[model samples]
Target: MISTTVAAVVTRFAPSPTGQLHAGHAFSAIRAHDFARERGGRFLLRIEDIDPGRSRAVFVKGIEDDLRWLGLGWDGEVVHQSARFEAYRGALGALGSAGLLYPCFCTRADIAQAASAPHGPEGLFYPGTCRALDPAVRERRMESEPHAWRIAMDKAVEQTGRLHWHDEETGEVTADPLRFGDVVLARKDAPASYHLAVTVDDAWQRVTDVVRGADLFEATHIHRLLQALLGLPTPRYHHHPLLTDAGGERLAKRRGSESLANLRENGADPAALAEALRRGEMPAL
Candidate 1:
């Protein structure tokens, strides 16, 4: 049994092994490490390599080396999402048995065409195409064809209460379900989507806190709802500011942004790099 020690605040740095760790990644890692140390807590490393198309072993190794060079260490063995596919599938099966999930046959173009009206964020919102389908009809379609699985938002909203999380930096907690509805739990290509993977991993690792970027603040509501639906404990959140490039755009691996490796290659000091990240400055690459 895990000890209920308030002295130990468990946190995790879950990075996708799709690309190199950039400045923003460093900033979030250092912040999580610092928070854990400050409260005498535990910091864990989790590789979110569920994306089979982009995730590579080389990138995962590079992330490990980069974090080590940054003078950051995590507790216990690193957990990889790819190895935990069974757990995600089990969770999905549980939800499906409860009639909370349905197979969605609508494609991107189909959703866009349905919402010929206006939408927000990514694009046209996901119409409840599959929500109204009878169980027999859905089962027939599932046996005859392939489709992505999506959670039923109306049922989720009715069964679960409002979703909310405390933001450490902002010191303000927010809750809004309308902003997030019927999020995809699994894709056609990958059985598990990020929402399911993250929730399952956090629960398995006993993460008490999650430290990530401010950009994911809104998405926390979706996660919280999933946690509630799965009957898992919700972790505290700390969404820190992001590091941007000279063009004022967010730093990304594909953009050739300053990475921990590039800084180390230039003989940059780890302590200095950590300090620069805290000050929101791009370390010398």
Candidate 2:
């Protein structure tokens, strides 16, 4: 439940529970938590454990444990994306009923083989092959083949028209859903895609400001369009620079960036560590 504390600003630190919390996670979490705390507003922690196969309960516990060790206290009960499948289904149904989404049967190899496939921030986007299929053909294919749901960018644009969203770092940016080209709303592995779940959750939580890393800056364009389509309010975004290692490379779990658990176990002071990040100084673990 959203706190009726009447605080003017509300922010959140949402992390995927697929691995141990690292230094980069700490920086983003602390920045969001402090932004709310300093303004006498509410700070929220949301578990973005959308993928059931990869997300482990131990990792989820580790995330909360690390946040506690860092001295960050959120205002309300933590929210979990896994528990909100029905809500996501409802939103997906809403989009489908409005003819804004269509089923995509293309696999990774299928997408890669498509001619003239344009690339977006993530990589080669969907080429909308299945989108051009006749309704009978699409229905027939849906009967036997597993598929994902994708937004129809062109049709969606016609419905909503030109739109824009605000960003603190880059000022206002015009929304460009086409660049993403019919991004997935639901995949076979998860009930809801990151874009759909996040857009829905932010509005449900009444988050007024979004603070996170700059990597997801491009996704804001699609999120902005979803908000417009669903009639949800757009939150002010502040995409801060990603925390980097001593070599000036951004930290990542896939690349084996040192986890905060590893750092804390090595005798680093949590309070001091938080202060070090606030000072823009990378700590020597």
Candidate 3:
């Protein structure tokens, strides 16, 4: 269990094994590492390879190597999301038992075609077609057709009342999880969605501080709600500014941003790169 004491800090650098570590990843990792180390706390590494279709073992190895080369070592054994299916199952079961979860059988195209579909932080919010389904129909579909599990946002919020989380940069902020309408907790193809897995991981690992890019700031609202629902602790957060390239585009794997391995292969100095990232400065690319 994580200490609730204000002095003990625990931070983690979680990376998905779907791509190489780019400069933005380096910056995020460095921030988490420095935060924990400077506070004489524990720093952890977590592998979010829950998406089996896109995750690769080779990418996992590359992640560790890149972090090592950057001189950011972690504490204890690394946590892998794929290995925690049973835990996620338990979390889902608890929420399901509470009647706060519903089967969502809507496909992406189905949602996109809905004229009434609303937009949210993640994209087009789920139209909630299956939210009020007949119990018999939901049971029949569960036994036959594959379906994702979505949290009943209204019910969950009612149970948890008002919620909030502290951000190191922004101070206290109110949570608005309803922005993502009926967000999926367990995906049809995966055991758990990003929101569920991440919430469970942080609580299980006893993370006291969450450090990541600003892009995930909105997701924190949903996470805070989950923590309340699951009786988990709400950790302090630091959503650092995203690192961008010369053209002002944020470094992303899908955008083919230069990877740390590429920089190493090109004879760039790892020490110098680490120093630049530590100083909140982008190294020469």
For this target, which candidate reaches the highest TM-score against the unseen true structure?
3
Give lDDT for model 1.
Answer: 0.82
What is model 2's C-alpha RMSD? 2.1
User: On residues 1-285, what C-alpha lDDT tens digit does candidate 1 reach at each position?
Assistant: 233344468988999998889878999999998889898889999999999999999999999999999889999999999899999999999898888888998788878788443564434667687877898998899987779898887788788876667777876565565555677899887889998899888877888889999888777777878888888877888888888777788988888777777777888888888888877797555
Candidate 1 segments whose C-alpha is farther than 4 A from its true place: 1-7, 116-118, 121-123, 134-136, 172-174
Between candidates 1 and 2, name the one with more favorable TM-score: 2
Best by lDDT: 3
lDDT against the true structure, per candidate, is 0.82, 0.90, 0.92
Q: What is the lDDT of residue 31 in candidate 1?
A: 90
Lowest lDDT sum, 10 consecutive residues, model 1, at: 115-124
Which stretch of 10 consecutive residues in model 3 shows the poorest summed lDDT? 1-10
- Give the distance in Å from residue 175's predicted Cα in candidate 1 to where it truly belongs: 2.5
TM-score of 3: 0.97
Q: What would the per-residue lDDT of candidate 2 be over residues 1-285, giving only the tens digit for each residue? A: 333233478999999999998888999998899988888889999999998888899988999999999999888899999999998998899999998989989999999998968787779977889888999999999999999999998899889999999899999899988888889999877779999999999989989899999999999989999988888888999999998987899999999999998887888899899998887677887
TM-score, candidate number 1: 0.91
